[model samples]
Target: MKKAELLRDALIAGNTWCRANPEAITVWVEKVGIETQATGEASFMYSYTIQALATDFPGDVDDLMLPLLGWVWEQQPDLLLNPDSNRKIEFEADIISDDTADFLFRVPVWERVIVTKTGGVVTAEHLSESAMRINSSEWETVFDPASEGNKA
Candidate 1:
């Protein structure tokens, strides 16, 4: 399928997922790579990550999700289960920039990263469900809205 079509389907899947999993905190998608075949047709791969809140959740990263949970506690950002609010939970790439980041502190977090192949093949892998405190500065950046006078 074409790139536009692929993107549309991915968005559709994300929306459907959001609908089915209301508790989902964030649905992040990014194009990871691209390859061209003999026909000159290029197929792009995308990566998606989603997180949520639930004690029953299978995996929790104390160092990452815990701080986010605190931000969510008072801010009550928009999530899968609660999207009616104007507030949004930002998904940032710089949250875990370095390897030692998590070793600094533990913050419970649960997230899943999924990859969509060119043909729409979906795959999920657990990147890190561990508590990471090294990215606290970035975390603050991610949740800056909570602290600023303005609320998004």
Candidate 2:
């Protein structure tokens, strides 16, 4: 699957409230840009929007942010690592009503594709951010190192 799809899935799946009440929320992922080099490695930037569709949602719109942020933290640590980078993740929210709102998140993330040739054929394999980690240990939020392995 593409990184955008994985991100959308993770955002929805990570939230217990979203999973339990699927009809109450909606997620849309749009590719913002792409860059390719001579090495065949391409970077895809995506903007995903999560909309609270139900008029009777039980919780505040802000409550839905943690799970999505957690997914980004674990899958794409670089966005959280550098605050001054232009590629940092960003987000905004528009409240449609007291119970419904639209949350748009701009995530500048890239998936590394390692291409190789074997005599007669060439193949490419995509690598996840966690797979390309510099540190072998698990990824932890910079704000709180003690919260390792906790997605939320």
Candidate 3:
């Protein structure tokens, strides 16, 4: 798996899991920590610690994380995220909770990230400078035939 694709899938899984995890619904990533682990019998493993605030995580972090990680593994067996891949990605993550919905924000969030792969070590590079801005539009409630004018 490539860097971009790996990040994309991880984001998607996060959003999906959040939606079902109540207090979730919005995956506001606050802190993204990366670490590598090594074992004598095998290669090093990469792990990510993605933290979130109460505002972004309505569900229990402990309860949701295991399943979320499981989903990621099931969906992507060749996950580019493993430490062995010699690859890592970073981004500002929009870092907001009041706006985007679940998976819908992946594009806007990831476009601002940097993916690094070192030569037998670690190298980093930015994906894009593309920024996402919300337009200032007044909220207009359309007529609901199912409800009376005042009820709407």
Candidate 4:
């Protein structure tokens, strides 16, 4: 999966919806760490930085982060569901000027390749799951509708 590109697109979509100017955002991604095994399994860590430039920056950081968080939720729901998970995403914000600000997010993205051979035939598969699960009580907590005049 193209995590960085998709994340950039998600942020752009969020900014367009909230600020109406997609051009003000620029995203850069770099790999900071990697782990690989002889068994053909590998994990990669990346830092994605988003730079927004405009004379008047509309909305707060939360507004910009909502979409990024949503994307992360889609990619790794376990990160949200299992608080004890060791892979913790980190983010930082730096205000460069009245017109420019930089937001840095460090996240782990991995690709695992599993290969099998039988009868002179070889098959390789990428072992990954992108799923979101919620239990009954958690579902109720998240999906319960708000009453009239009640803010979420």
Candidate 5:
């Protein structure tokens, strides 16, 4: 599947799952702007930052994130085989310098499932790890303050 198609499938699947299980799953999308420096006299550059959130699952956060990741992996197998390729199922974009864009889609499970103080049945550590992997792989620069200053 094409990169955009893969991302679309993941988003649809996540939304479907959330809709089907509203009591256990709460999914939402968040769009953020990313600024990058241009080589020339460009005033600004922007990219889409999409995150998925799944909450109140019966199992750990990894349990939810793994399935979402699996959907992404199944749709975009090239991402697993190619290190340099931008074939992620969660976020896909063709950004240009000095432009603004917004991506609307279902949020990932990592962002939602919070561990309660009672430690009911979910654990935050697992979710944190899975989120870390996704962040490091696809959303690496989302939290980087230095990258924001790169804009003109």
Candidate 6:
């Protein structure tokens, strides 16, 4: 499928998932495009944003989204990590929880596709490292600043 089409589909799926689960207060998708300078190859990346409403629910936002995220990863393992291709792609999902507000914010579910051309043969490799890094950085940014003042 074309990169645009894949992104559109991912967005639609994410929105539907959020709506079906009302605990989700906010949801959106982000697209990241990466291109290689020497190879002139390019790929599109997809991620999801979700925020859960405050309620007495049993599970946290991460708990709910992790499985969904895993499903996406499992369903599209190639898009997650293509080993045979020089092309590289990456994706990540970010989930956040706020005990003070009793709410959760989940953003940036990830997808990436990489394409490379060598000897007229095209290859691709999907990398999850970027996505994981993005999610971790985002999470840290959210909580790290707040935790700074509490240092003993």
Name the regions of candidate 5 deviating beyond 4 angstroms: 1-20, 23-47, 84-152
Candidate 3 minimal-lDDT segment of 10 residues = 137-146
All models: lDDT? 0.33, 0.55, 0.33, 0.54, 0.37, 0.40
- By lDDT, the best candidate is 2
Over 1-152, each residue of candidate 5 has an lDDT whose tens digit, in order, gives: 02233443454454554446545332333453434345443233222333443333333334345445555444333344356643443532223223422222342221212233454563432111222234343322332234443211
| Candidate 4 residue-wise lDDT at 120 | 85
* Model 6 misplacement above 4 A: 1-25, 30-33, 42-66, 75-152
lDDT value, residue 111 of candidate 6: 47
The C-alpha TM-scores of every prediction are 0.19, 0.62, 0.24, 0.56, 0.29, 0.28
Say which candidate scores most in TM-score. 2
lDDT of 1: 0.33
Report the C-alpha lDDT of model 4 over 58-146, residue by residue, as the tens digit.
55666666666666656655656776853576776677667555666665555444567789897766555455566443432432233
C-alpha-based local distance difference test score of model 6: 0.40
lDDT per residue for candidate 3 within 27-125, as digits (tens), equals: 334333343334332222223333332234433443334443333333332332335531332223333455432221221112122345567666444
Model 6 CA lDDT for position 91 = 28
Residues 13-120, model 6: lDDT tens digits: 544443354543333434443434455547554443333232333344454444334333433433334455213333233333333223333333344567677999
| Pairs with backbone N, CA or C atoms under 3 Å apart (clashes), candidate 6 | 47-109, 48-108, 48-109, 50-106, 82-126, 89-127, 91-131
Please provide, for model 1 over 72-151, each residue's C-alpha lDDT reduced to its tens digit, 9 standing for 90 to 100: 43222223223453233443222234332221211122233334456677554433323323333444444445544332
Residue 129 Cα positional deviation in candidate 6, in Å, after optimal superposition: 13
Error of 2 at 30 (Å): 4.5
Ranking by lDDT: 2, 4, 6, 5, 1, 3
In candidate 2, what are the lDDT values of residues 61-99, reduced to their tens digit?
555556555666666666655556535556666677776
